[model samples]
Target: MAEIQPVIEVCDLCKTYYMAGGLSQSVLKHISFTIYPGEFVAIMGHSGSGKSTLMNILGCLDRPTSGTYQLSGENVSDKDDEALAIVRGQKIGFVFQNFNLLMKRTIADNVSLPLIYQGVGDEERRQRAVEMLKKVGLEGYEDRLPSQISGGMQQRVAIARALINNPSIIFADEPTGNLDSKTSDEIMELFAKLNEHGITIVLVTHEDDVADYAKRMIKIMDGEKAYDGLRADYKENQGA
Candidate 1:
């Protein structure tokens, strides 16, 4: 059998921000990990724990100050903003807590927004958007405006948009932050279904309940990796 290549690899990753006064604060310190295809991994940390910064780097929205990030076997840690944008368009999908939909736009338009950047034709974009919406269980609502839908439904639209690109991985940052517990559970079940179908998902959240849906967890504390293992093990250790 052929060896499976990791979908993501980070080694000695470090991120530091220099203030205007020449003071520097490091956000991530020498963090390293590998994520294989089809894994549902949660990156857990408090507000100041640097998980957001790490997510930005992994999603190619920002670059690291030092070290390497290999996504699907390509080094993207040092790519310029334009290059990184291209990489993100081609390989990454992002789902955010705020839903991030344009209230004025139709659901189909919002779901197909990424394709507009790629210059896909209008009809094809609509067709693809409809297919993706169906995948997320929002099939007939494509003609509705984002403002017309409930928060969870809007999030489903966001997830549909994320899927339109057929990305190598999805980065979800506090994806359930805006929803109630019941709605959060629904959304998490959706993520679990996506993962079961071989979609690689990397979710970042501070809530243990939210992170519990993930098969594995990587916990960050004060800019350092505090734990990396199965989620069940982390829970067990915490109880011990």
Candidate 2:
């Protein structure tokens, strides 16, 4: 028997942005980590800690300036934009702070957007979208538009949209940032349930309460990983 490789493998990853004249800004310093299947990992950092930058790279929305990134064993560092888009749609799901849904579109229509890009037939697309909605506890809300639902329900619809393609990893960037504490707990519980069902989750949040829900906690400081490990004993080593 062989051990399974990580769902995401990032090594010596660095990113630098060049200003208009000549100076450059470094967003990610030689960061490295491996995210395995069925793991729920939370990255905690204050603003300007590069959490969003890391999320963009991890979600295939941006390429790194240097170093390696492998997704399911395939080197994605050099993939062209089109290839990256394909990988994003096929392997990664994204949930953001703002529920990025079309205001006028029905929940089913929004969830079906990904399948539409995959060129799935109309009937198949609707069926798959409905199935994903059911998984996210949004069955009856399929006919409602984004504005018709509560913030939490809209977020659930966003989650369903993210899961429509059955992605191996879900990248959630402050997913519950806009919700009330109660709604936030509901969403976090939903994420835990999803993780139990075997979907890898990588979350970015600055809230300690939100990070506690994850099995592993990764702390970032100034674009570098300050700590990464199990959350059980994270507090024990606070001063160590």
Candidate 3:
């Protein structure tokens, strides 16, 4: 059988910031990894560990100091802002620690926001948004505002919005950071269900409980790749 190409590839990636007075700091150092289709990967790191920076770079929100990032076979490392935005809109979905929904908009409207950029007409956008909401078990809550829902439900809305675009990969940063343990577990299970349907998931979190949900775990320490392997192996190593 032919080996399928990776949906995401990072090679010798590095990110550095130049400061005032000629000072400089590097956040990510020579990080390299590949995420194949249908993979559920968690990147675990502590504060100042550089996981968020890596997520931003992989999601095309930022560029690295030096290295290559290929998404679905396209080298996106040097793409201009406009080009990057186009790729991000077409190929990537983002879920953040805080459910970044507009409080004034209805749940359905928030989910439909991405479709507007794709030139999807209002009617079709409504259709797709509701369909996605249904998939996330929020079918009847479409008319509610973000402020009206619980934190978990708001996160569900975020997930529904992320899926409405049907992107190849979902990048979630601290997706359950604000939720309670039970709620966090529920949200992770939702992510697992999405992964089961073949969407590639790469999430960043500091909690081992959250990391355990992914099939593979990548540990980053001080801006470098520390460990990359199956979640079971990572757990065994964690135990040793």
Give stretches of model 2 more than 4 Å off. Answer: none
Lowest summed-lDDT stretch of 10 residues in model 2?
231-240
Report the alpha-carbon TM-score of model 1 versus the true structure: 0.99
TM-score, every prediction: 0.99, 0.97, 0.98
Question: Per-residue alpha-carbon lDDT of model 3 for 54-119, expressed as tens digits?
Answer: 999999999999999999999999999999998988899999999999999999999989888889
Worst 10 residues of 3 by lDDT: 229-238
Candidate lDDT values, in order: 0.96, 0.91, 0.94
Q: Order the candidates by lDDT, highest first — what do you get?
A: 1, 3, 2
Q: Which stretches of model 1 miss by more than 4 angstroms?
A: none
The RMSD of every model to the true structure, in order and in angstroms, is 0.7, 1.1, 0.8
lDDT for position 82 in model 2? 99
List the pairs of residues colliding in candidate 3.
Answer: none
Winner of 1 and 3 under TM-score: 1
Give per-residue CA lDDT, model 2, range 1-240, as digits (tens). Answer: 999989999999999999998999998999999988999999888999998899899889999999999998889988999999999889989898998999989899999888877889999988988899899888877788899899999899889988989898999999999999999999999999999999999999998888888999888899999999987678668737
